[model samples]
Target: MLKNLGTARSIFLVAGFALVMGLLGPMPAGADENCREVSLPDGSVKIICQDDGGDEGSGGPGGGGSGGGERTCEFNESEIACSSEFGVWDGRCYARVASPQPPKSTPVWEGNDDGVILECNPPGCVGGPAPCPDRSFYWSPTAPAAPGPSAEELAQRAVAAMNLTMGEIGSTPPASTSDPNAVGTIGLPIWLWIADRAENTVGPITREESDGGLTVAATGTLERTEWTLTSASGATVGAITCDGPNAAGTPYDGRNSAEPSPTCGFGADLNSSPGSLTLTGTAHWVVEWQGGGQSGQITVPPQSNSTQVRIGELQALLRN
Candidate 1:
């Protein structure tokens, strides 16, 4: 049913699809029922062979297992047509991930270039992992569990690395400002000025699914509120409280009204020292994420995003 046309490297994808559809060969009656594989603990390596002619656990070098223990199989899923024939060679049942592929001159064989190509594809054994080719036999009494944290956990870690902020508060860039009102000085009405929101995402992170094999479902959420850490002379003055960040945010975002902000807007006392005028903004963030059947929440310590403003008395110039 399978035949080579011209060059071995010229294995057409259409031909592979044809074989899968039974266009070139009798579509295996029960498909996956016929994909029999067996492995034995022969030394460090085991034997793996596929027999479509027999029922499940019916054929192979040592016959398929009833327990069907788990094993690692790596393969380039995108290229199913380059199926290399699984053969017993040099003590191992097949070429391992460690064994480099036959050189390019051999023939565009398995993704790694082995010439012995198979005519059919195995059921549910299509893809795995990042991009790489691997399809070797493994022997175990029970399926092996993953060794590290789930994909969601990794995604949460990626999200935490972003260190997001809500721009700067007060002043133009939260630095030295010529306007006394933005600096919270005495006699002038000052309002909380928060910059635009700073948003971030670690992107289309991936995770392994128990059902349809490996599926991508990343998990992470970041929620934050703004508050000013108002202090003076290294002594506690007063806290702005955890007033909902929404009401305390953006006093200068084009609402062109002289209306006084009752939340975070106020004037410093004239008696307050001009020498140590400190206006700071503290952002409280609550991060929560869930993935791979597990969930967690992280309360990041508030720091780093606070801005420093240089306060100087605004002197008025008298003209004659």
Candidate 2:
């Protein structure tokens, strides 16, 4: 007896075969047609193949009719297990991209004149339990055929693969001033910046990902840094934002020691009493991607890093 298939059950059953072995390896070189490698959920591998005349003495859906006689085929509700890297689409599993290029006239590839995307269509088997696609590839112009998935989707995938981050917050006066007892003076400038600039942090870093024949590359650059200044008592006092190419801010050198920070700095009116002020710096990044004849921008979640600063009033001394 075979389970009823809601959709194209006959086609899938007629052409597909599952090894059902404990562990299977990749399809060997020069393998037979209508076969592809599949990875199972339990970290095991299996091979699914489409076979001609695979259906033998098996009852049709619900075990009603004889198997050897004329078999009826119809689409039914059935779970199609796709390979790890593939996705199910339009009642068929699709690879990331079509290998060869489908003609512009292809109904599915109508608007896309760009590049090639590979497609593997499922054929019919008489009464096979598991149905998979044939190894033969087709040209679909659009990867997985457009309107299904777009380059932007791939771009987001690349961004996720990046695992981006922001560096620690640095200050001009240093979190702990040279004179431990001498805290930052109120009404004076406090410079904030990225402590360390690296590939993953505050970076103009680039990354790329490839699948089938399609490739996408993305670059992330620091756009700005927003600062929140809070008093020791947890009261919100000031908010400073630094933007532009120097979002990371200029590290304090001996030069221009008296002037305010040219790029990213502000004067705090509040003073730290029992506890020190908390300066939290949030990094903003803009990621731009270009691939498949398209380019776009993306903004990732803000990364935050904090440092503590103590501010106090400078006492003056008068001489007789």
Candidate 3:
């Protein structure tokens, strides 16, 4: 019968059919009796291992056999367990762990050919030591709020400084003739008042801006005039009255026609001592006129001709 059974099993295996073993006899004691059947949709058959009577098969303690075992094992998508040796170091059990590297060192400064040692502390450092201090040291402290000068104070200081630099009391350059038909040159003298030696004499004068910043009015008496002409032969001629306030009609006005009639005031001596004249002071002038039956004031801007005079030069002039 065993020979016939072996032959029959061979035929079924070759025919790709399922075969059962020991179907008519009892299995031996201590032998696994549990059987597992696996069937493919294509009619293929599989024989799985099993456990019997507390016998532990290749499956682990729960009898859900591990590796090649007879038990059906269910795996959860959310729960995971690592198996390979490499997976342990890769943080498969938890989140990945990172290893840290060392920090970089600070750079040092070198001078010329020699290398100097420098010390550093939190915030900043104090170069060298007390006795032999470093060539250079710097401290960066919070700055204090700055104070500002008042407008009047600033203006006063500027005016005083200017006076000290320019000369006190000078005359402006003579103006050229106005009429082409005029025979002789027509000119006017400008007298400057300087209070101190430290003051600057005049500001800049420019015609390009307006009338070349020129003042044509003479402050002294044009009438009752006196002239002592000396000839080339060294002969003194009698004083003659070439022209006066009576001669020239009211001192020909050179002011702009659009402007009001400008008047020239009497020349008055400025009371200044040797010391007072040397001190700095501001120079100012005003123009007043009556025109169109209306009287008003016009302030002339300080020109280059207006300046601060220095005290030292005035003192020297007094000595001369």
Candidate 4:
């Protein structure tokens, strides 16, 4: 029996040793094939070399082989750690250093927590935000300044210069024939005198009061013979005797002196028929002195035979 047990035990022991050797192979050499490939949990793969040996695991090409297990990446505050070196890609950061990232672009519009829209231009790529386009809409051209004198002032000055007394006063019939009336008429003599020299003919008369001075103005034609002055003695004064251009003896067209002097002659006798003093004569005449503006004259006709002489007063008033 003992002899038989020894043979069986020898067989069993040999069989166990063969099984152990089959289960464990010898340590691989450095010269062995490197791991060719590896796969990560993220579904990415890598190649490794054979020389790294099966113990170091395998990945595709730089250290490519096969049979390495899956890898996982570990995340931390400073860096992202991985279960295996190949788990993190080349472009990714590791425990010690981080990879560079591209600059971020700014958005055109920003939103607040409440979801309201706001405008903003971020600095970076080109500099800052662009300015908004100009939006002005309306414009008006300036008006040119008005020209010349006001209408109102010109109208007033014009009305003040019109001649009316010449025709109105002289043409009126006496109040009564028996009254022996001697009413005089005043006028402007020439059209040229009125158009060019009327203002100059009359003395400078202002709106202001003068020191015991009076202004005399002539209207209508000077040749109408409408104006005269009588003395208190009941004598008739003749048409004014003017010197220079307006002189009585001098022709109407003749230019005598630079300034004209006009005088009046007196008429003789007085009528006591209806107790009226009939008088006829012209007294007032104006000549241009400083400026050659114009000249004026007042004429009177001879008294009617109904009255020998009549005394009348002469006066003048200015409008402007």
Candidate 5:
């Protein structure tokens, strides 16, 4: 016997398993006999409730049809009734789908979040002397149908879930290189890059989502980063698109500080703007996905990260 848990519920019976979706609500009288409880493969109990004939004539794609004419159809004709709103009448049994859908919280589709209906054969037939067979359902052919998102769309959603980002700008001179003064010489090469080349920032990051019996997964990688260096006055000074194997840019060690960055670098003008220089790095990402027996690549918006550094001129060089 299952206690009252939710007003409405959808049962997802699949691959040797079952999932029930519902919220807290009151159960009607006689609901005990109308519902059957089964133990899930995971040792959890799910209450499969029989659809009341109330939704009859609700009219829509998933709506319960006219009340009088076809309502006489029953699963076994003796113990179970076929007047449920979860399936259609197709002579032998209801042609249904055993597809997985994205949760409401992360909807792959635009604006529907009530939940999904677990379509079943024989309409109202859930549990009785003879129950629905396991995995005997067809794929969701028209449920999430046209106007619904495709595998590629789900892949895009998977990529979005990764929350990709660009890292703060890093420079060879190290913004704090001179403590209380200038950190770069007006004419010296200042190494530039997107700091912290990690999975989240410069990926090879992966994520996935399952729907309509297929699971779509996407992997994203940092393809390149475009860097723009501007003077304090907002005038462009230099630009470089880092597309090398190490596109994140190499950090500067003291040994190579004097030399221009072998990967990405720029020299300030002798008459550069009076104060700081703005360095901005925009990251480009390539996301590829495989699912639904197919695969493809996606283009996402670029992410930009920036930082400022103080550059000064050498008044009078005094060397021995």
Candidate 6:
């Protein structure tokens, strides 16, 4: 049942054959057209060759079927297993990209699988998978790929570097205005100061690739904060500050309190009830990052904390 197949080169070997002992190595070199190799059910290798290259029982060329019967053939592996012998595939191993250039190779599929990818190039076709056609779906397998995964990884690192968390915010108002609860007369000014910041807890976010692994580093700083003050008294229009002041100076105007803040302060006429006025600071943190040959910045949602204040009128003494 041997047929004359053209000189095909790459060889794909299945694993089970190696485990068995009875199977012999490839047949001697001078096999005629009637010669063919077969693996018996017991894992034995045999070559049946005709005295002359004949069409005795060959279905067609290498079809290996008898009595005009047509045996089906198909490809199975999705890729060329890098370690496979240069030639057609035998459907059992993973495909790998061949390297070192100009290595043209042809694939000979041996199964009911048709997903194999084959390539042909130079130096007598000894290596590598073929290049994918243009305008097609391209997936990265250690090949030249666009900035997709790397970009995403860099973005995540930037956020962690900023480390804009709820626990990082604390107050540093003037000493006299430091009281969580304070009573001020009409026409009086309440001073404010920039809240104290916790030292650098996180660093800028960046990406690094080494030893076949990717690592992301994080570090960031706050750019600016948006603040608003709400009053419970007759004043509906509360004071808002967009200006970021470094020093806790409030003109100190004519107030008796120490270090009254002009930037981060609120003045109220009078609250009808207790604990009605509130001063809330919302910090809009901006984090910037660049690494892994890419750079970008992201803004997180506003994180805020509030302080309660009470307003009352001062009683004048009668000098009778």
Question: Estimated TM-score per prediction?
Answer: 0.40, 0.51, 0.15, 0.17, 0.51, 0.42
> Candidate 4: what lDDT?
0.26
lDDT of 6 by residue, 142-242 (tens): 32211123433555754654456422222322222466454644445455544443433221233332211223344445444444445666454454444
TM-score of 4: 0.17
lDDT of 1 by residue, 209-319 (tens): 222121223332233444443345565433353244443354545453344445555434421434444556655545555443345665656542455443345678999
Stretches off by above 4 angstroms in model 5 are 1-149, 176-182, 267-274, 317-320
- Could you give candidate 3's per-residue lDDT for residues 1-320 as a string of tens digits? 99999999999796653324445343333354454333322233333333233322221112122232112222222212221111111111111111121111212111222322211111111233322211111111211111122222233333333332223322111111222222211122222222232212222221110011111211111122222222334343222222332211123245432222122211221211111111112223233332111233334333322222111112224553
lDDT of 4 at 189: 23
RMSD (CA, Å), candidate 4 to true, equals 44.7
Query: Which of the two candidates, 2 or 3, achieves a greater lDDT against the reference?
Result: 2
lDDT tens readout by residue for model 4, 1-320 = 99899999999999999889668743233333543223222233333333323333222211121122212221121222121221211112111111121112212111112221111111111222223121011111221111222222222333245322211111111323434554422221210111123322222222211111112223322322233434455564333332333312211243332222133122222111122333332313332211011123323222121223322333678899
lDDT of 5: 0.58
Off by over 4 Å in 2: 1-150, 177-182, 268-275
Q: Among all windows of ten consecutive residues in candidate 2, which has the lowest summed lDDT?
A: 57-66
Please report, in order, the local distance difference test score of every candidate based on alpha carbons. Answer: 0.38, 0.58, 0.24, 0.26, 0.58, 0.38
For 1-320, candidate 2 gives per-residue lDDT tens digits of: 35545346866654454443224544542385555454332323345554442322222211112132221222233322222233323233334454344455654443456655454434232233223434334334444433223457767888887777768777755675433663666766777778777877777888886543446789988888898878778887778888887788877775754567778877644323324777788888889998655689999999887767777666799999
Worst 10 residues of 3 by lDDT: 86-95
Q: Candidate 5 residues 56-94, lDDT tens each?
A: 222233222234222233333332232233344433334
Off by over 4 Å in 1: 1-148, 171-174, 177-184, 187-189, 200-232, 242-248, 253-258, 266-273, 310-320
Give the Cα RMSD of candidate 2: 18.2
Score candidate 1 by lDDT.
0.38
